[model samples]
Target: MPLPLAPLIPLAVRLGLVATTTFALTRLVRSATHPGRTDQRAEDALDDLGEGLSLHRPADRAEDRQTNATARVRRVVRFRGKTWELDAGLMARVRLNERKE
Candidate 1:
């Protein structure tokens, strides 16, 4: 007697559809929650340019140094009005060194 296989085809298709749907939804939620880095980089660049062009007294060297140091030490991402530190330590050091010219 041949084994019956017709009954499992629909069940397998439904299971595959559910899995694909769940994976897509998870990716959509993840992307919605995390803003892209390009936007953040453009904002930072604009802020720096504005600071450089301002008529007011420039920020003191000490303050600038402190800001640069802290920025290198703690990379953060802003999402949903919340700040999250994303990288530090060795990777931060590597990024800091890349600026040397």
Candidate 2:
């Protein structure tokens, strides 16, 4: 008897289509270049975003980093239940943080 080939054939075709499409799109994006190229627009847009976007000013960046470092060194994790304060998580994190520092 012949092997069951009907379902396998369509699956193979779909896999081939997907592979070819992925290859084409990968080439499209990876081969990006300057003006007059296929992916010039995409490349230029990404370049513009990288050049234009800034989350913080240079003067404040140091201060922000210092604050974050200090907090990371000092913070304690805790879950508050019916009690006024939960000390189990807090004391453990504090001990660990203190040891690390």
Candidate 3:
């Protein structure tokens, strides 16, 4: 007797195959670029953000206090080019005068 195809294959196996193909394509494109052509823009952006903010990993009884303090400090600001706030999400952008519109 032949086995059922859909029931025999697990969902994880299908997802893994898709992921493997994507990784292969990404590597191919990355390798196609010359070594010196590699851009440090992304790295530089990350370093700049790290300089502006610090992450606190709490492990003690004071974690809750620290978290609350940070949360309360959040505020909205309006300025020359645009209006926005420096919060968890904007922290990633870390740009000045940037607005959604």
Candidate 4:
């Protein structure tokens, strides 16, 4: 005997819609609460390094660092409402040297 799938189709569609709505709402809330490109960038870099490095920046200086880079290969980031200035080239160089040792 074949089972009935017609009734399950509507249920499945409703569940999918709910899941998508929840996901979208969560993202919207997160973005609104924390609004800064620098903060996001810094967090991503730290995650990539996996060096247990933490971010600390002064609230007053956050705006300035967010728009400026220390060097050609440098980037500014904000972490926990603080500004972090990172020099990617220098970091890479140091990492390379460590590997060569």
C-alpha local distance difference test of each model: 0.54, 0.47, 0.54, 0.57
* TM-scores, each model vs. reference: 0.32, 0.32, 0.27, 0.32
Q: List the residue pairs that clash in candidate 4.
A: 38-78
Highest lDDT: give the candidate number. 4
Question: Tens digit of lDDT per residue, candidate 3, span 7-79?
Answer: 7578879899999999999999999987676458845543344323344534553524333111113457899
Residues 1-101 of candidate 2: C-alpha lDDT, one tens digit per residue: 98888879989999999999999998888789545646777455433442222343344445344221111122345556433432221111111122334
Q: Give residue 7's lDDT in candidate 3 (0 to 100).
A: 73
Query: Which ranges of candidate 3 are over 4 A from the true structure?
Result: 1-8, 35-101
Checking candidate 3 for backbone clashes, the offending pairs are none
Report how far off residue 21 is in candidate 1 (Å): 0.3
Candidate 4 global CA lDDT score: 0.57
Candidate 2 versus truth, CA RMSD in Å, comes to 20.8
| Model 4 / residue 28 / CA error / Å | 0.8
